[model samples]
Target chain A: MALLTAVELTIWVLEGQIPPPIPVPGVKLGLASVVTLAAMAVLGRREAGCILLLRVILGCLFAGSFSAIIFSLAGGVLSWAVMASLIGLFPEKLLWVVSVFGAIGHNAGQLLAAVAVTKTPGLFWYGPALLTSAIVTGAFTGLGAMYLVRALRKYRERRGF
Target chain B: MKRKTVFWLALFAVLAALGAGTYLLRGVAGRRAVVSVDGEPMRTVDLTAAAVPYEFTVETDYGRNTVRVSQGRIAVVDADCPNRDCVKQGTISDGAIPIVCLPHHLVIQIED
Candidate 1:
C-alpha cells in the first residue's frame, strides 16, 4: 500500500506540471487514478481507499495549497467510492467501464465542490464539457490499470510472493 | 466484438454524443459579462459598449484577480493564486465556459 501510495503521489505531482491538454477549466487527465483502480483490483477496496486517502493528503501537502485539498478530497473520495462499489461487478477485462463511471463521479464531485465554494450555479454550465473529458480520460486510465494489474499478477506468480 | 464490449461502447457513444451536443449548443455570443466573487455579483460589464479594452482588480478575502474586458470578450489577465488557471483560460466571448479561479473563488461568465 505504501509503495502504491508513493507511486500515485508522484504521478499526481508530475501530472500537475503539465498544462492541461484540454484548455477547459477543471479538466485533467487524472492519471493517478490508474494506481487506485489497480490497487483495488489487486489488493482490496480497503487498501485502495487507504492509498487514495494518503495520496490526497500528502499530495496537498506537497502542493502547499489549502483550497486544493478540498477539491482533491472531494474528487478522490467520490471516485474511490464509485470504483469500490463497482469493482466487484466488473471482470478484469471490463475494468475500463468501471473506471469511466469512477471518472465521471470524480469530476462531478469536483464540480459540486466548485459550485458550493463559489456559490455560482452558473458553474454547472461546464458540466457537459467535464463529462466528456472524464469519459475519454477515464477509458485510457482504465486500460492502463487493467494492464498493470495483469503484469503485477504475472510478476507475483513468477516470484511466488 | 463481444456483446459486453459492444454494449459498453454503445453506451459511452450515446453519452459522448449527448455531452457534445449540449456543449456545442450552449455557447451563444453575448454582450454582457458578469463577474462574481464568492457567489455575489461584483460587476457587470457590457462588452459591446466598451470602446477600449480595460482592466480591473477584484480583491476578496481569498485573493486578487485582474479581469480584462474588451469589445466582446473577457479574461483574467492576472491573479495572485497559485495555479493562475483563470489567467491561463485566456478569454470567453460566449456563454460556453466561464473563467473560473478555484483558488480565489472567482467566476466570470458571459451572458446575453
Candidate 2:
C-alpha cells in the first residue's frame, strides 16, 4: 500500500510537470488516475482507497498548496466511490467502463468544489465542456490502466506478489 | 446492435447532445461582460461598445488579475494566481464558459 502510494505521488507530480494539453481552465489528463485504477483492480477497493487518500494528502504537502487539496480531495473521493461501486457491476473485462464513470464523477466533484469556492452559479456553464473532456481523457487513462492491470497480473502470477 | 454497444451509444449521444446544447446556448454573442468577485458584482463592461481595447487590473482580498476588454469580447490576460487558469482560459467572446480565477474568487462571464 505504501509502495503504491509513493508511486501515485510520483505520477501525480510528474503529470503536473507537463503543461496542460488543452488551453482551458480546470482540464487535465488525470494520468494519476491510471495508478488508482490499477490499484483498485489488482489490490482491492480498500487498498486503492488508502493509496488515493494518502496520495492526495501527501501530494498537497509536496505541492505546498492548500486550496488544491480541497479540489483534489473532492474529485479523488468521488472518483474512488464511483469506481468502487461500479467495479462490481461490470465484468473485469469492462474496467474501462467503470473508469469512464469514475472520471465523470471526478469532474462533477471538482466542478462542485470550484462552484463552492468561487460561489458562482455561472461556473456551471462549463459543465458540458467538462463532460466532453472527461469522456476523452477518461478513455485514455482507462485504457492505460487496463493495459497496466493485465501486465501486472501477469507479472504477479510469474513472481507471486 | 448488442446491448453493451447500445448502452455506450446512448451514453455518448447524451453527452454529445449536452455539449451541443451548451455550445449553442452560451456561444451566442453577448453585449456585456459581467465581472464578479466573491459572488458580488464588481463591474460590467459593454463589449460591443468598446471602440478600442483597454485593460484593467482587479485587486481584491483574494489576488490580482488583469482583464482586457475589446469589442465584443473580454478576457483575463494575466493573473497572480499560481494556476493562471483564468489567463489560460484566453477570452470569452460569448457566454459559453466563464473565465474563472478560483484562487482570486473572480468570475468573468458574458451575458446578453
Candidate 3:
C-alpha cells in the first residue's frame, strides 16, 4: 500500500507539471487514477482507498495549497467510492468501463466543490466539457491500469511473491 | 468484441456524443463579459463598446486577478494564484467555457 501510494503521489505531482492536453479548466489525463484502480484490483478496495487518501493528502501538502486539498479530497473520495462499488461487477477486461464511471464521478465531485465554494451555478456550464474529457481520459487510464494489473499478476506468478 | 464490451462502448459513445454536442452548441458569440468573485458579480464589461483594450484588478479575500477586456473578448491576464489557470486560459468570446480560478474562487464568463 505504501509503495502504491508513493507511485501514485509521484504521478499526481508530475502530471501537474505537464500542461493540460485540453485547455479547459479541470480537464486532465488523471494518470494517478491508474494506480488507484490497479491497487483496487490487486490489493482490495480498502487498500486502494488507503492509497488514494494518502496520495491526495500528501499531494496537496506538496502543492502547499489549502483550497486545492478540498477539490482533491472531494474528487478522490467520490472516484474511489464509484470504482470500489463497480470493481467487482465488471470483469478485468471491462475495467476501463468502470474507470470511465469513476472518472465521471471524480469530475462531478470537483464540479460540485467548485460550485459550493464559489456559489456560482453558472459553473455548471462547464459540466458537459468536463464530462467529455473525463470519458476520454478515463478510458486511457483504465486501459493503463488493466495492463498494470495483468503485468503484476504475471510478475507475482513468476517470482512466487 | 464481446457483447458486454460492445454494450459498454455504445453507452460511453452516446454519452460522449451528447456531452460534445451540448458543449459545441452552447450559443453564438457573446459581447458582455461578467466577472464574478465568490459568486457575486463584481464587474460587467461591454466588450462590444470598448474600442480600446483595458485592464482592471479584482482583489478579494482569496487573492487578486488582473482581467483584460477588449472588443468582443475578455481574459484574466494575471493572477496571484499558484496555478494561474485563469490566466493560462487566455481569453473567451463565447459562453462555451468560463475562465475559472479555483484557488481564488474567480470566474469570468461571456454572456449575451
Best by DockQ: 1
Which has the better lDDT: candidate 1, or candidate 2?
A: 1
Query: In DockQ, how does model 1 score against the reference complex?
Result: 0.71
Error of 2 at B18 (Å): 2.9
Off by over 4 Å in 3: none
Q: Where is model 1 chain B poorest over a 10-residue stretch in terms of lDDT?
A: B80-89
Q: Compared to the true structure, candidate 1 yields what TM-score? A: 0.95
DockQ for each of the predicted structures, in order? 0.71, 0.54, 0.70
Model 2, residue pairs in steric clash = B26-B96
lDDT of each: 0.89, 0.85, 0.89
User: Residue by residue across B72-110, what tens digits does model 3's lDDT show?
Assistant: 989899988776767877878888988888998888888
Ranking by TM-score, best first? 3, 1, 2
Name the candidate, 1 or 2, with the larger TM-score value: 1
* Best-to-worst ranking by DockQ: 1, 3, 2
